[model samples]
Target chain A: MKRAAAILGIGTDHVYEVDPDESGRVSAEKMEEKILYCQELGFSVFFVGITAGTTVYGAFDPIEDIAIICRKYKIWLHVDGAWGGSALLSPKTKHLLQGIDKADSFTWNPHKLMSIHLQCSAILIRHTNILMQANQMCAGYLFQPDKHYETSLDTGDKTIQCGRHIDILKLWLGWKARGHQGYAEHIETLLEKANFFYEIISKREPCFRMVIKPPFINVCFWYVPPSLQNIDQTSLEYNERLDKIAPRIKERMMTNGTMMVGYQRLDHHPNFFRAIISNPATTKDDIIAMIDEIHELGHDL
Target chain B: MKRAAAILGIGTDHVYEVDPDESGRVSAEKMEEKILYCQELGFSVFFVGITAGTTVYGAFDPIEDIAIICRKYKIWLHVDGAWGGSALLSPKTKHLLQGIDKADSFTWNPHKLMSIHLQCSAILIRHTNILMQANQMCAGYLFQPDKHYETSLDTGDKTIQCGRHIDILKLWLGWKARGHQGYAEHIETLLEKANFFYEIISKREPCFRMVIKPPFINVCFWYVPPSLQNIDQTSLEYNERLDKIAPRIKERMMTNGTMMVGYQRLDHHPNFFRAIISNPATTKDDIIAMIDEIHELGHDL
Candidate 1:
């Protein structure tokens, strides 16, 4: 999105980022405030990007309220559902993306949650004609007028590229094999496993600290060693020390080759492990093993 | 290249095109003239794109002289060797890309002449650091400071994309299976086959009017029917009628489902067939069969 803004010659000052709530979800009020702030600065609110599932905590923004603001401002609402879009298949979790139908455009990657290999992403737009209007080059040599079949089916002109990879076949076949119900069940099972992890970490108490109640599959947490158990959580020195634990534990995890989990610092927070449960194959054993491995590696720290 | 220029905010007037010579190759003099014209218009010559193998006639530009002009103007020389880069593997055809080492950057597609698969292309740059310098976002969450092993190997920062397809594995494995010698022989064989087609088409005289002596694998020709056998080649009406022949014949070919060949119109020229011989599996019989099929399908036209 930054790249697109840069390409369009939008300056850094014009690009505003609204901070998310403590739960890592962006409120509609914050979005409206940012829009009004831009309007006050004499900038038109052309595009409003809402993260359907954020990277760190897998938090879903309040799309319904955000949609109302976007409609009022006449802005093109784009949803980045790259990680969390698969949850929409589940009947129980479909409410997470309640106002998704109101979005002007949405980007989803089947490769992530669907496990259909890498580079299988799709950008769906409300108006199909807009794609051709924006991208059609009408290169006479390739896309000729006189062809055997319906020329509209020839997708070459609608794309920016001359040649594209056949990344759709695997996803098509996978979807056919799994069916809609199978996919929903798969997503539901993963979320349930994430909930299990959240419960287990909460019961562990001082040994582990749950960052937030994850709304989706990404569970953010930190491993607290016995040495740091007595330290005040609000202390600057404590967070500085806590920041060192994850990277050290990650280093040991790499060397030991037991399990791998991603760690990152998100806005004033210390480095914490972001455990993703998108893989349907992941069992309770794998989740338990990850925790035990992190404790075993960093308990002395 | 045009798309890149557009993204960089260069207008169509600033983008100049130097026509190829009678032999279908762009000369150094023409390039220098274009560069001088751009300078006179107060435009900086930042990039000089030299086509290694043109689409219509498979012509190779005089790169050695073009490189010298680029050096004098302090312009970055980029060679579009998408079609002809595989010729580098062949000892006999390597002379076609004589001054390739002098180019600042080059685009090569292993999917084309090398016949690996679709969408396997590479952008080769002389300077390694330039890519990272231009593209690095410094996204702390994704590219962390503390990681195991060499962080320099993480190519995500060097690319504009967050997630990229693993396109190198197939190319690597294919290259390993077929060593340098095998690839050289493969390219040599294809070129030899193209030469055989050129010779046959030349011998066939009035039936097949050869466009130009192809420098590479593309053999451009017109399959003249018996109806227009006696007409003047320079007549406007004759060329107009000739233009209709290819599309008509192409329609017949598709309906018959015998073989497929590409046809296109160049500057002031009628639509002529461009028989590409990139397929190593193509035998002399296939070439002979294609001509026979064209004759059989297009005789009435």
Candidate 2:
């Protein structure tokens, strides 16, 4: 979203919760807030960065009729699917990105979730000549009349950088090596693992309070340590204590080099340990071990 | 001029030399004619691509200053020195590019003559904050609001391309390897070669014509073939014959593989061959061979 906004010179975006609200569909409320904010600020452009958790907080469009309101207002809508966009391939989840076709631009990162190496992101425009219009430099040596056809959009020109690395070679090879079915199956396995963790952790004795139980792969949970037994804890205070605890736990986990997890504050909460399992190398045993280690780390506290 | 105008979202620039009086420098008279033409056509910008023999046309400053003299002019002067800007290294030749400092933006390619690699070109602004202001994007993964440097410029963001290749690495390494003194010496050798070529080619014969020979590297000349004895023909008709002879002669020379030379029509004048000697591998003998090949090629014409 930042790269696209910088390149095209317009728009602001807000992160969307991947899961649905109480209604069993992705809530458009956060998007609505951002849109209203853009309106308040008099901006004509809006972008949405959508990722995991669609089942809990965000479902796709409930009615196709919202397209009518958007067209009436004339806001240039863009979808930033740098990671979760790969889910577009799955029949079960494609509906979650329902009104996406109405967007003016879509930025998808093949590098992130798609097993491709770093830096294979593309911002595809829907309408006419845009990238070229934004970044054409008639460099005499680089773009001479004699050899114009050989110039493959000079992708360097449209980009916000000069002399960009050629990431297409890796993507082209990946497509040739692993067909769509293989990638879909990989995604399915990850989803299954995510769901398995949710089931186990929810039932465990020293339970994790899931700020988001994660419809997809991102799982956020706080450890209710024994040291906080006497304190009347609000969600904010517990989160603050978790913030103090999360880093030391995460660092200790990293020293082993066997299991890895993500830890960060999402929304208003402070540091809770979030397991974002993008690496397929992880197994159920590793997850159990991590949870056990977290419990051990928090027991004395 | 074209690439940058395109980068800045301007359209095609009709590339035509305003050298009516046939002086190498753009004279005040030519400037007057160009200004009149631009105004007649209702142009808001003037891009100046500086070159040698530019004195005959008039120095860029007086011409640009007079263009600035035109009222209500939003003329954004851009100086494109993808070749000759290296003159800044020398005190003497530096005067040639005097008012270039006043340009809104200047583009100079180190790759062309400064012995840098393919993409080591730069567009320098006196104060470059405007460029950052123009290309800012609010990307989460890239530009974050965390406790790092915020206002400081990352060279990456200022570019139009993302996932940038480190083209500057070679230039930086070269600068470090061969300090400024080494580069200046290389430039001095280039000056010597330019003077050498100017001396040699000018001495060739009446059959040869020197169009623009400066102290710098570019030396353009026309090969006027003698028709068996003394037959004068139109330069256009003469060049049409020479064109057919030159390439066939060049093919045989290339087959020998001792050398190669680039020949092209300059400024719509079919009367000349442009001999650009920026390559460090070139020598006095190579210049001699180039002249010999053209002369030998002319005999058959």
RMSD after CA superposition, every candidate: 1.7, 7.9
Which tens-of-lDDT digit does each residue in B108-176 have in candidate 1? 999888878887899999997888877776877788878868888899888867798888887898899
- The whole-model lDDT of each prediction reads 0.87, 0.59
**Model 2 C-alpha lDDT per residue in residues B186-230, reported as the tens digit of each score:** 777877887888888778766676765453566666666676225
Q: Let me know the DockQ for model 2.
A: 0.13
Q: Write down the worst ten-residue block by lDDT for model 1 chain B.
A: B3-12
Candidate 1 local Cα displacement, residue B111, angstroms:
1.2
Best by TM-score: 1
Interface RMSD of each: 2.1, 7.2
Off by over 4 Å in 1: A7-14, B8-13
**TM-score against truth, every candidate:** 0.97, 0.60
lDDT for each residue of candidate 1 in A125-184, tens digit (9 for 90 to 100):
997688777666676766677676788988887876778888899899999999999999
Candidate of highest lDDT: 1
